[model samples]
Target chain A: MAQARQEDNATDAPPEALRAEGIVKRFGALTALSGVDLHLRKGEVLGLIGDNGAGKSTLIKTITGFHRPDEGQMYVDGEPVSLRSVAQARALGIETVFQDLALISELSVYHNMFLNSELTLKPFPLLDNRKMKERTKQYIDDMGVNIPSIDTQVGRLSGGQRQAIAVARSVYSNAKILLLDEPLAAMGAKEGAMILDLVQKLKNEGQVSIILIAHNYSHVFEVCDRVNLLQHGRISYDKPTSESSVEELTELVVAEYRKARTTS
Target chain B: MAKQAVGGDVGASESARSSPGLGSRVAELLLRQREASIFFVAIALAVYFQSSNSAFLSSGNIRSLSEFTYATAIISGGLVMLLICGEIDLSVGQAYGFAPIAMYLADQTLVLPVAVIVGLLATAVIGLINGVATVYLRVPSFIATLGMFFFLGGVNVILTDGFPKTAPSGSFLTEILGGADWSGIAWCLLIVLLMHILLNRTRWGLHTFATGGNPVGASEAGVKTAKIKVGNFMLCSALGGFAGVLDALRIGSIDPLAGGPNIMFFAVSAAVIGGTALAGGTGTIIGAFLGTVVLSIMQNGFSLQGVSAYTFNVILGIAILTAMTLNVYVGSLRRSGRV
Candidate 1:
């Protein structure tokens, strides 16, 4: 029945842009992700909140095709899709901005922006550096990304600026579904505002879907349309941001913590 | 990427005005690093040696020094590529000798040209073995290539019974590969120029830098790091093979122990002194070329001045140590944001 729904393409649109059902990932004897189901409709931001070792990162890795699930079903636009590599996920218009930012420290901003997807003329694999640099400058300006120059190495920048670059890179990849793993950490006031605005713009366009992993409830409350609380490798709470309050999310986490403490 | 950035010209005029200053500052920073230091050391050594023996600056001595650096420079090109890709092939030294020995063994049956091809094929096979052992077998390149080094060297010795082969003298293959004149130097220059372009201007080269800088990052970015490394291993072995053949042609004979680990050590030192980081992610082909020149100059100058072998080794060792220490220091400066 799940396979049939995924294959149904007669309708004009699918219910969800990206979805995963029963994702289970194991590393040796330990299960990183056990039966985690996630949902994000088109043009929606789903905030993923979790405590330490709550398997948020593992879920992201599985979805991004970094760590293939040991057992699971992943669907794109209601079509069953198997993601075997990051490149495959990218081809499906699913781009991820990892917390590490995935930027080469030695490379310049422009180089990092086009790290895997470089511009090159046909018949020869030489880089079009001029075009790449120009395009990167254009992107930074449009996004108001606080960068000194396109030529500056990403490592030389402050942590906030590096985060800005990662967001810009994902946004530039033209992703239909973007995953940001703690993108706001170390982000400065101005840069954070710019990234927030960028996400808002993409959300409003009704063309992109987003899944953000954020620790702060306030940030999640601001822009995320819905929130899912991942507890112990499972979704313990899921609701629209309007239906949920910070006090309620905090109470839920605190209860879980107390329960775990008492049980242990 | 996303329909191209719409408003890209906001600060174009302003940054254009500062472009000249920024460009120069970047260049100044680059020169402040390891490359310039080694260049100056090479020049200073030249001046000092020339002052001692007027013949040190003679055209004959200069030509000889240039020729001496040819094989080392060619092999150093591949070594630098491998090193930058986060692996090293110590077997290039033995692979070098193996190429010529393969040719020599083949020459006993086949024609000279056929023998050269066989020799080159032999090196490629050795390269594949080294690459497979490292990439597939999960052996670290240092240990894998080191094992190949001894294994190949022993094979050359055992097969030849420790006797040198008379290099084929009159064939067209001999004329070209042996460098009837300074052709080996030309080959070295061509290889350096090609590799320089490959390392800086091409996508493959960018992938190389990415792989060396952060293997995990590069892999995540869709770069097949394993394939890149394996390709580099093959390229290094091929270049080693070419250099081995060229050296045999020039020397008029193939010494059973011609391109030993000691010689590979000198080539590696040239790369390190030239700013190719032993730790990877940083290096320049031109720097490697100049480093080979400096090493050759030291050897030539010291020998001309009647320095004993023991003293020459000691002095050369000290010089290399000092140069490499400087390289490490400058590299740290880059990490600290000085570059």
Candidate 2:
């Protein structure tokens, strides 16, 4: 797989799996992302942190191709490309788990897993629900997930289970780069820990890269190899977690706040 | 106790034990599959009518009732699918009469088999138009088909010049398509079973359910929601045309003026009464079949009891409302985490 990806990305290649530079998005009078540059390495988790309206979500959206940047260049596996739609991004192995999770709550777990990519038999080529159900069991077990029934509707699962299923869907879709937007938001303390462990497990597998957005600084520090802080639609802080402490990131935010107050 | 019974999770007793079961799990399961109550209600009505009238349960009476309903039931199968895909085609009623008239017009110049083929193809084209208008033109299907309902009704008058067309008869095909030759029931049952397999066992069926359940979610997951909806529209009209031809052949003439919005309404109600949803994303073919059966039984009972036509209409209206209310209520309960 590594050799094939390298061969396909022989031209205009960058070392990172995904790279974005000078991304600027404007909404008439308001600018959502102003010249933001971010890069994700292979099999590494990058924590994205920001205050309210800090452009973190905007950057994630741009990366997932939900919103196109007015001025920017994006590269997938070293090849420069422009994505016009989320479907296009998915084709290039980019998957995003939005705050809403984009889940059909009324459908079964197995059905949702193969929502758009259902297995079909030859000749007649009808949906292979039995196979999908069996595969869903395998995927969940391999990921150490504890869903009660693969055939049960996703709406019946607990909040964290729902979040995990959404994350699992992205992983199971063969996503090369997974973007999670506040997956732990409003989750119970135990559920939050459970998801963190799952993310850590995916990280250990070393198959897909991760970009996680979270409000909790400690959780970010716990799971992220590196962290980026978005401020006023630009990435203001990028540092390795080993070299930077949570206290230091907190101080940077405080300093930025004081500077804003002084200027105002 | 009841809820757990309905939400039975085999091999997972811990969670089931932790949560109190309030509603009958059996009732809940019955509602989800949408079979138990409709079947029960139909049987109950059948029993009630049998007790009241000596002829109600007679084999001849039952067979005749089925013969009356087979065409509409066939059309309802298609409506059940379309409704599940979150759309409707009111033009079906017109297509039913229109196809036979087209067949009659073509038969004047061509052979019977060729004329029949032309009629079916023409109806398929109309169905394609309905699908394209709704999907590509971005017009809501309800309004687009409503326009078709009126436009096609006007076309019926223009085609036969305001007179019932004398249909060419005594053909083997007509006997199979309609007539009291038992072939009509066989064809209807064959279509119903084929449709049931398509909805439950095919990828197309899964896509239909996904498209209706959540279009955005389905699209994001890579489903072609618009395509599925359009396909269902065509399926609905084609079946509507087929049913129309059957009814015309059985009655021995084509009456454009006789069938209007009423037939389409009856078919839709039959689907809903059986447990197919009006709001989409949920339905069953068996339920729709049962629904048509119940309506047929009720209509037969009313006429036998010597009820006036106007009184029977009121009673039928009440029946539709009660069935729809029950359907919607069961739906809401399911959404609240029972099934």
Candidate 3:
């Protein structure tokens, strides 16, 4: 079935933004991921759903180069690549917004926006704060993210605002493939809505391909173009969102729980 | 619930925009700036001392006051940076004690300039060891540096045989480094200024802040947090050594017991009183300089007033407690945006 899908992908479809084939990861006596295959198409949002400890985080970490799979062939833009570090992955325009959002709260919004990739003055080894602040303000405003001021410390901003800034930082850095891990996990309805709006806007632009890892089936259906269910370290179900429903996804997950109950 | 959260954020920002009364504004400014409040306290103490003892502000007394302030100021400047980057060197004072002895021993075999370099290199190596132990060996820096403190203290006594040694005489280097009346303060101000620039304007400083603010986050963003931390430890120890050499040059003697835990405590206290958080991620070199000034003023003022040494310690303890309490209170006020 996976081979047939790959043939279909090769014949007629949008180009693959990223593809992982036969990925396997092991830790000591435990196997976290065993022969997992996943594909993300260009400019599409793929919702990745899995139960806790189903190797969801491990897979994301592997793809982001925070982990090295024992066996895998990963391709970026149809070109095979071996990623050794997060910096190398970033060099290839792949960015991950982890669950914690990876923001330094003591730093100002502009500073956080340009944290590691700071702009420096040409003549001196000094940060160009003025230019960075100005550009951050313009970029944030253009994205329609409501921040009090660019100079405010990120810790002072609301969670939703902080998440927006994280997403914006990734987008601003020209990420071609953005992976968001639980972007709306603990967010309120309004804040979740805000993030959904931002994702929808990015989807409309169709420039950055995204893989959103979420637990809520409704959230997955809201913005995802396709859904991939990870179970027992494999993609158990892959279908377009238009061809699937929340009830179907829930039943698939519940059936696993029922099987475990009977076997135990 | 969501509406309340959003409304709360908007309300806080809105209140920040709306002006309060003039009195509250000034109060707010002082509360927001740990340095400004401490500077005022330093000035107030100076004024009181001058009024009580007419000789307090005399040129002779001023020179002595600066002599006391320079060593602490220079050491605290480095401590501020270290603390901001989420590390500390309890052995800095030992580095201070060790450098002059190293310089003195090296002066017998090498040029004075070469000997000074050797002295600084010795301290830098000590810093490197501290960094290595903390970063790679996974030792907590507090315990690592404390162990270094005791280790170096013993090394200092062994090196000097528990006796003071006279610094090399009549070199022009001494005159410029610390022998001249104003040279110590000159070096102090210059170092403080450079440290201020390094902390506020440079990319290294920004990375240092980021590394301390959130180590995991900073590393995820590709910031070399381990390098930044190790580099800060080296810089702190180097500065401590520099201050020790300067004092030895000025006094023409190196005491094995001098610049030990007392000086280290003073430097740490000054940095904290100046607004450097012990939890790290925030600090100011200029604030640390002002903090040194406050400490120096209290010590000088009490001595001029004929206060006993024991009584001065009592006052110093009380003063630290008061300053820190006020710092915490003011910090909360600033966070809540209520002065």
Candidate 4:
């Protein structure tokens, strides 16, 4: 938060890791996101806070290529990019950990981590079981968290453990930008702290630009360098965490929620 | 706790072991009611007839039953995969008709292997067209395959002039496809066995489940779900085409009208009975095989035991309905947190 305030004072331009310019999205008669601009720098955690229906999901979807924005452009590492599909976004080193977790419950930890992207031995097409299992174990060890086993089915995993796996999966993809949609929404205080620690760990590693989206301003304020508040499909306030309090962000979100409710 | 103790003795290592076991149990219950019920009923009647007539298990009757299983299982295998991906191919019956007729025509009019290749290519093309239309063109597989059905059926009628046409008698190719071994299993059963492995053990097999489980989720995981669906549709039709060729050889004649009807019903029946969901996800190739065997055994037993042939239809209908109901109920339980 201190560093974010310093950066804000030094420059008002977009950060280098990720950027969006005049992002606009519409669904039939409704505008989901309108003329929104945001950016993230390497190793910086950006908290995206918005009321329900304030286009948080739409913005994430558009960035992740699940839904393309009707107007505006997104850039990764200062290069123009068009995300036609989720696969394209992933290939572009932009990994999104959806709130649903999107994990296959029946598969083992390693299998779910890799999913369709299983490492296969060419010429025979047999999966490199040893490599995948070993890599999965290494990731578990690297994360330094409590996981039962690499062979554990995701369904049997606790919610916190499942979230850990989702994080591990995105990190394993070697993503330059990690978009986490409410990673701690359904988690307990302990789990939320563990995730915050993990986010901090990743930040310390300085590997990627992480975007944390949550309605919980407390958690957001704990992890983010900069916070952006959305109201009526536009960025209402964008400032460093040092300059904003949890109460201010909560008031903004609640006000926007009331306004949207009355308008609808 | 006692149940847990008993479960341990019963080989329960998984705490959620109950879920998988319950899934298979539900599958078994549905399996018993659908394709297997008729067989069970037929077995009961067969025992009665054997006790009374003493000629119910005759080799002729056994051979006839086995033959029915051969034809039904191969087609059902492909259909089950299609069902798992939430698609259908109404044109398979016609594909069945066309493949053999085309093969016969190719051999007699063109050449041997070349004609066979041509017939297969034609079938593959039909599959390709269906895949493209369904995946890229974004049409529901039901409507697209239904359109293919009418088109292929019409083509069959026009090509064969509305009657059965005999292929040149005594071709070695025909013998291999139509002829049976001492075990009474056709050579095609080997192909079916290979398909079983391909569906159960391979990566594509898992991909089929993934594509069906949630197409959006699968795509997000980079599964190329559309391509997978297209490939599955093509694979189903290819198998149908192959089955058609074998049917021609077995009958020693090709009927333009041979395959245009009842294939969707039979294949879907076999699939549903085999524990494949019409809603997609969770299925087995062996179940499909067993399903066909059960259905055929019932029909054969009815004919052998001198039961009314009309009764077989009623029994088949009841069996299918029972399987479907069981499947629906168990599926609902799974969704409702009972399983």
Ranking by TM-score: 3, 1, 2, 4
| Per-residue lDDT over A1-264 for candidate 4, one digit per residue giving the tens place of the 0 to 100 score | 556656674787545888899999999999999898998877789999887888999999888899988999898888999789887888888999888787766456887787777787778676676788999999988987789888766766788898999898999889889999999998999988988999988988889889999878888889888899877788889998878998887776677668869999
- Candidate 2 residue-wise lDDT at A133: 90
Off by over 4 Å in 4: A1-15, A22-34, A66-74, A78-85, A104-110, A127-163, A185-201, A254-264, B1-61, B180-186, B332-339
Q: Encode model 2's per-residue lDDT on A1-264: one tens digit a residue.
A: 544544554564436879999999999999988899988888879999999998888888788888989999999998898989888899999999887776777678988888777899888888788899999899999889888999888877888888888898899999999999998999999989989999999998989999999888999988998899999998888887777888998999899889999999
Please report the TM-score between candidate 4 and the true structure: 0.82
Candidate 3 lDDT over B82-130, as tens digits, reads 8987888999999999999999999998999999999999999999999
A best-first ranking of the candidates according to their lDDT comes to: 3, 1, 2, 4
lDDT for each residue of candidate 2 in B298-323, tens digit (9 for 90 to 100)? 88987888877788789779988998
* Best of the candidates, lDDT: 3
Interface RMSD of predicted model 2: 1.7
Question: What TM-score would every model get versus the actual structure?
Answer: 0.90, 0.89, 0.95, 0.82
- Off by more than 4 A, model 2: A1-15, A251-264, B1-29
The per-model lDDT (C-alpha) reads 0.85, 0.84, 0.91, 0.78
Candidate 4 docks with a DockQ of 0.29
* lDDT at B113, model 1: 90
Compose the digit string of candidate 4's lDDT tens values, residues B64-109. 7677777667778888787777777778777887787678778777
Q: Which ten residues in a row have the lowest lDDT in candidate 3 chain B?
A: B330-339
Per-residue lDDT for B1-339 in model 1, tens only? Answer: 443443455467558655668767766655565567668778899999999999998888887997889899888888998899889999898878989889989999999899999998999888888989998999999999999999988998987889998888786768878657877898889999999989888877888888898888777767788888888899889889989999988888887887879768878988987888877777788888888989898889989989988988898788778877777776677678755
The lowest-lDDT stretch of 10 consecutive residues in candidate 4 chain B is B179-188
Q: Which of 2 and 4 is the better model by lDDT?
A: 2
